[model samples]
Target chain A: MIPVLEAPPRAPSLDIDCELAAAWLVAFLRDEMIERRNVRRAVVGLSGGVDSAVTAYLCARALGAENVTCVRMPYRTSSTDSLDDARAVTEALGCVERTIEIAGAVDGYLVNEPDADGRRRGNVMARTRMIVLFDQSAKLGALPIGTGNKTERLMGYFTWHADDSPPLNPIGDLFKTQVWALARHLGVPERIVAKAPSADLEANQTDENDLGITYLEADRILSLMLAGYADAKIAARGFAPADVALVRGKVDGTHWKRHLPTTAMLSNTAINEFYLRPVDF
Target chain B: MKLAIVQAKPRKGDVEANFAALGEVFAQLASEERPYDAIVLPEAALTGYFLEGGVYELAFETEALAARIAALWRAAPGASRAPVDVVVGFFENAGGTFYNAALYLEIAEASHRIVHVHRKMFLPTYGVFDEERFLSRGRHLAAFDTRFGRMAMLICEDAWHAIMPTLAAIKGARVLVVPSASPGRGFAAGGELESVAHWRNVLQSYAVEHGMFVIYAGLAGFEGGKGMTGSSALIDPFGDTVARLPALGAAVLRAEIDFSEIDVARARLPLLGDLGSVLPDLLFDDDLMPENVRRGGERPVTP
Candidate 1:
């Protein structure tokens, strides 16, 4: 007698080979920064999160610990644990560390608009941190390396032009869960890896709470959605349809944020419009 | 015959700098204990791969290309005394139309001559590739005689199509040299980049199926953050890897290969012979034959 058999579940995974990813990312940073651009030192903004810690570790590995400078930019409302975790990363890597308080700089412009919302204040602080980071980079002749992960960038959770301002980014292509996996593989501190991610712009601001989904869920949904899967197909893979819709909405709606500003193309030589050149060119 | 695969990382839009760098590599190879009979470099070895509209500015005219390479060979320190063949990929400006082409040069102690030039046949226009937008397509394919034996060259995307290699094999090419600037992507497969793993399979299959030696030189380094995977390899006629470079970096890999292995492989398998005998009939099938030929009016001339 013939028997019917059930198919195996098709659960999606954001899993990557951490060893290969680390090696490729290290080589990428070394080539893009030291060899291609002829810059040996790197400046990374440390937010005491897994993403920043992984970036710091990669930078140290690529350019050596002596060439990486970790800057901790905290606002008045930032948690002390955040600062401690950032210090722990610097100590673990044996790289240069600096703590720059941006309360005065962010408040200087924010004082004129007391009615500004939390988002406005957070963006100001983010821009202020970038200003300080760029100034420090110029002072040391070091290039600023971006620490934003693919999940946050795709979700449009970063401050436009501020959090994504750096000219070199080794972790931009990695998803949040994938970055955490890489952090653990690189021997990052378990405290930073295990803690809930936050921007540290305000109190009790957890990323999962803000995004309404866990990073595991977001990464899985994103991996499937970005591969051109329909929402129904993604939902069929044991994900909630609402969550898939949310992730898809964020990814599709934030397309403009991922590109340079649109230019008016009145001629054949319009910059970034008609005329084209590779980024390195 | 001894062969060397040079996985090079050329600077973007810099022809003179790349030429000088290649000269250094040539000089280094010359001083080695064993001299190589042939050396192969990756596609767009003079200018980086993703030039877009910048190809117009960086392309070299046919005469200038031969002259520059000759000068580079002559000026290289510790130049090899024996005649050596070097295959290089470059953007060419031929009769006002630009093409992505490979130049085969035979260099001796006092003079150098152009052996052949193979313009890239397939210009990938999908995904990360925009070659068709910037370069003209090649219209011909032929196997040329070299000191090492009869050989053919296929640029990066051209090798992806099976017809290119089959045609080369049918044209009596004993060796296939592929110069590539393939960007590394798709790492979900495990240990190496998926592109690298896939390339390994493709290269081994080609070597085994055609019973021809495959020498692949892949570009290294980054262009616009896209890393060119460097898994340059020398595969023997039996689909064995004789030498290989690392997955990423600019390096030279050298190996001494026996040309007699091609004869042994073909003697045992004879896949090329089998394919050649059946290809004409397959081309003349109902679906493939021209209307006149299908109607038994006239047989088309075969090139």
Candidate 2:
């Protein structure tokens, strides 16, 4: 485990011009789908969160409302407000909407393992949602557009091979803070943006409550650390040392989750070492 | 001199839209504290290169294009310090013939001058390139004086020819600027674009061999289903990459180049010093060849 710093780092300015960012994201989504993927339709999993809402909005603008589909995968413990927010996004964007409950699929596996904890149950739910999303993708003949933001990705806050399983992601580069900014820019409802961020894995669980650090603080430290700043320098920027260490530890510990499964390199003709091609190609 | 290379995507067949985008980029750069002496944009930046049927309509006259570009520079936010020279690629319409050309503009406080226009000499006609079909080819290859220093411009294919850079160096050019719109092709096993790697090799060789600064500004984003490799870079006299923009995106890369490096490298290598003696042998001469080969009818014996 990485050692904890003495103090938390101050939040750095990570503001992005919403109009320019919206235009770029819209173009990227449209180009990646039509030019690269050869598909005009897009499917997004909306959890009544800012990331998904903003991604769905951008997709609607890119591929048009007729080409975008918003899927809501709610568990038994999922909040009613989450469902409302997801529906609101689809309605506002004038895109098609579908809701497929994961309670039956998740409980089918959990029934055999009575001692399965919240983390295990949550993984099962996330993966089940992914399965449903992909199924709906096939049914709708659209690409699965991901809503995972950069901050959550860098800190390994997302479930491996589950929430990050989409083929194309528009918000993967934007930090969580930037996503909120963009959400507001895209005219996303204030209720969704102001709501406390949650994975909805369990009842009454918030992301900050679980991580023990605000995204503003985490994003600042992560950006600095990724930019090649030393911990000493980051600490000098008024970040609490404990929060810094915790954020650093999460990023360092989850390195494996960010990349493809490591293949043993016994020969030069290894898969990644030879016969490589871009996924879009 | 400080130079900035803009790796940007151009709207195909829309010169007005591209000009507006370029103006925004210039304004963004001007707002920064970094002082740039020269700005290099990608080949056919004003009118995208792959416009097979629209080249005639998109091509601009030199005088009108210069006036519009001057207005953009004049409207930039930064106050005038030293004259910032701009090297931009465009489709030029001269006497009803269209040519792929690079226009060099020297922008001053209240006025701008069109210094030199280097038309692309070698029109590529093979494999994804169909330049000779629509555009007329250029004839001359020469270097011209700029506010920063003596420089030469090459549009895409011209830089690939050895004679172009050699001739530019012989013409007392210390800086070689290449504007390209080459499509991205072939990915290596490690997921790197092979076209970018190939360009780095090609550009670096010219910089190191001639002991001159080579600036290669490649277009970014997709055009006609082909992704342009945006490896716009500035290579120093020592063949070191001073600055490089990331591939497949729009960016402005800045770097400071010391002109003295040319003198320092040439003094150490002495390749240019021996060129005078080697030129005589390189020139084609029928008498220097075998009798059978010189007749142009018979094949010469190997032995």
Best by TM-score: 1
TM-score of 2: 0.56
Q: Which stretches of model 2 miss by more than 4 angstroms?
A: A1-12, B1-171, B174-176, B180-218, B222-303
Instruction: Report how far off residue B167 is in candidate 1 (Å).
Output: 1.7
Tens-digit lDDT track of model 1 for A1-281: 89989898665467789999899999999899877889999999999999989999999999999999999998989999999999999999999999989998988888999999999999999999899889999999999999999999999998988999999889898999999999999999999999999988889999998889999999998988888888999898889999998998888889988988777778879986658888887
Q: For residues A1-281, could you state the per-residue lDDT of candidate 2 as single tens digits?
A: 99987886444457676765576567677667885557999889999999999999999999899899898999889999899999999889899998888989999989999999999999999999889888888987889988899999988998999999988787887789889988997899999999999998899999999888999998889888977888888988889899889999999999999899998888766775543323432
Candidate 1 lDDT over B1-303, as tens digits, reads 778889999888877788889989988887887777888899998898999888888888877887777777767677668888888898999978999999999888888889999999999998889999888999899899988889999998889888898899999999999999999987777788889888888888889899999999999998878999989999989888887898788999988879999999998889999999999898777876476565546666889
Off by over 4 Å in 1: A1-13, B290-303
Best by DockQ: 1
Instruction: Give candidate 2's whole-model lDDT.
Output: 0.83
- For candidate 1, list the clashing residue pairs, or say none: none
Highest lDDT model number: 1
